[model samples]
Target: MEHQIDLTVEQDPSRSYRLLPEAPACGPRELTVTLRSSARDVVEIAMWSETGLLPQPRAASHHARLTIGADQIASLSARLISRWQRFVQFEPVSGSNRLREKKPYLHNANLTVRPQSELLAQVSELAREGAYLLGELLAGEERALVRFRGHLLNVLESEDLRIRFDSDLGVPWPMLAVGCERLLEGGRLTVDPFRLFLGHRHQVESTSGTYPDYWWVSDRHHAVGSANLDKDLKNVPLADDVLKLLNSRLKDLNVRHFSDKLLPDLAQPVLDEDVMYFFCHGSYEEHGGRTWHALRLSDELPIDAPLVDGYRKPHTDAAARRNSVALFHPLVVLNTCFAGAPATTGFTGLSAAFVRHGALGVLAPQIAMPQVFGAEFALRFLTCYLDEGLTAGHALLETVRWFATTYRNPLALTYGLVCGLDSRVVTSPQEGTTGS
Candidate 1:
């Protein structure tokens, strides 16, 4: 009853995997919705479920074209995105930009407009509306969507559902709402839809497919790891806590990568790391005519998408020959602002750069997070993932639930998965045969 996947990949030589213990197969009802740009203006929605559902008792999948396009759907989210800036800043944030969040503790003496509360409702409402529109979009198609809605309704209160979108539309699927109210006309949800925010209530991840590659733990001994933390923030208490967490999980934390004392070493093609974590500033820059994201590991220069790709060029020959990715697939956690948002043309950003180079997946904030909350979120997420042994998707699910219900913070709702929805840390290979 192990849920671990066996994806074999050949290295220049070899690498370590993980040990799998027996576990149960029963889990939350899950669905993967993939949206792709078909004609620049037009888009397609492909829905499928691996678990049973109503309208149909069997698992199912269906593909159909949407009359509405990505451009339109993406446009609806702009208000939420733009208005969101008032709530928090990047680098988690800096003193110059108000690093502390303003949303959680707002001046609501009159209760007229609470940014956090209102934003949550706005996002949740949009999510629900999107679901209803889907039913309308597939008006004449097979019951694929019909069954899809049925499954969504089934998980409304359970709040333990798993929904993943393999998309390029840039519509934040995690923020999209789903409910029975609109679909049923007068059926008000027993629970508030804002509480049903997909990112808050369920385990949701947005993914972008990569070039063909199989899974392989990047570490030679499953003990080596790196943390590309910014030098300036290294002394913060939470930053210390993070280093301690990594120290415990990894066999040998690469001290040089801590602040990359050399900084330029970041561009060196890496093949030995099991996990690459970044706790630094994330910013957007205009390059040529396109918007690209960059990461600051030191005061010298920024590490942008192209520079990230440069690291992998050295291994191009090997990857091409093996029909596999050149870089060893390490799990990447980007606790930086907008690290989760990908360009609609396809994923193009700091996070995507790592994903493109073969990181197991990237976990990042879709928007700028408050520094304090950002640190707390990283602590909890990494704990659930590294210590508790949950897949990245489920870990984020539990993490959001904890923050929303217990801590009452909504920023965690913005974390997105750029791939590896089902990726978990590989402890070692299963008992017997060589992981060949």
Candidate 2:
């Protein structure tokens, strides 16, 4: 169903507000307030006097003030914009936040939040009642400070103090301070962990930015025992017992489907009936102080060219095409560690890049972990995918089940390694071809 949320604010003249204009529509998730007089001096106002996550505006008027040296207002405004942008970035499922200022004493703001959960009930709710929870679940103050271009035209709220310090010359102190407080004290809204995960995945699907089968590129290498390797070099490492269980679930199955040249690189080329599987390695590289994901290729050339060519057989490149390595695509499965590390690199890892090119999906780890768990998880997951005719997500769910049952661990930590595509997406080159 369609998901839409609209919130408005107005100045309450009945009660004098320290903040220039009073906005009643300011709720837990978003706020829009107009300041009557521009805040030049440090003005105090209640931050959540109108509303917040607890279902009530803060009873105690929390102070928000701005007082700083020259150009502090501009800095504060920039900080506010930055914080709002960050909030919107995480709430990717929602449309871009539309922030409009109403001059002297008013500002309008809208935002959304989708927290990842590891519970099942939440998943069902998200699938059926996503819009319903928009109001209840997205209730938290995304705190940030806004120093105007000019000094305090006038104070808004009295109880909530808005303070400004010339010493706060660096980043906006109020914004960072509040954000830190929330991170340390205010945890995410309580929800079914499974449903939380489901909701997060659903929202991810709804985002405009592309998500690769594996957004993060892992640098960790996969070591295939001699017994597991097919002549084509594709590694199928499922043990006999696992294979039996898998075969029993999937009919009309053939092991050769994975062995044939499914993976092609720029050094290799593609051909008819070709199948491609990419196992990319990535890591955060720190040079001089800045760090980025380290990419490995058969050659030094940029990955975009081969990706542009796709599966069509190329004459000049055989090794690259036959081996089938794509820098970006849905078909590639990146099983690297922190392949999609956060903060520094964000989502530009191997997995994300591959998806942007042409990959239907990806499978990559999100955090650092032992090699054994990752390998076992990957093997079990692949076996399920090929043998049970399961979709990537379902297969992952099953894998998690297996882990929970086999290890008997009440808690298992693994980043959500999602396959970003519809289940109908074809892995085989010929699957998309018209009638024979």
lDDT of 1 by residue, 102-122 (tens): 444332111123344454454
Residues 1-436 of candidate 2: C-alpha lDDT, one tens digit per residue: 9979886765532111111122222112122222211334433333231233222333442334433322433344343323323322222222455433222011111011112242222322322222222111112243423322111112211112212121211121211111111121255544322222221222111112433222222121211111111222233343344334434433222332221223343223322111123333345566576545543333232232133334432432342445433332223444444543333322244544444444545555444333334445656766656545455555655665565445422111233333342332233333332321
Q: How good is model 2 by TM-score?
A: 0.37
Q: After superposition, which runs of candidate 1 have C-alpha atoms over 4 Å from their true positions? A: 1-13, 17-29, 54-60, 87-158, 180-194, 217-222, 235-237, 256-270, 287-289, 323-327, 343-347, 426-436
Model 1, position 259, has a per-residue lDDT of 32
lDDT computed for candidate 1 = 0.61
TM values, all candidates: 0.74, 0.37
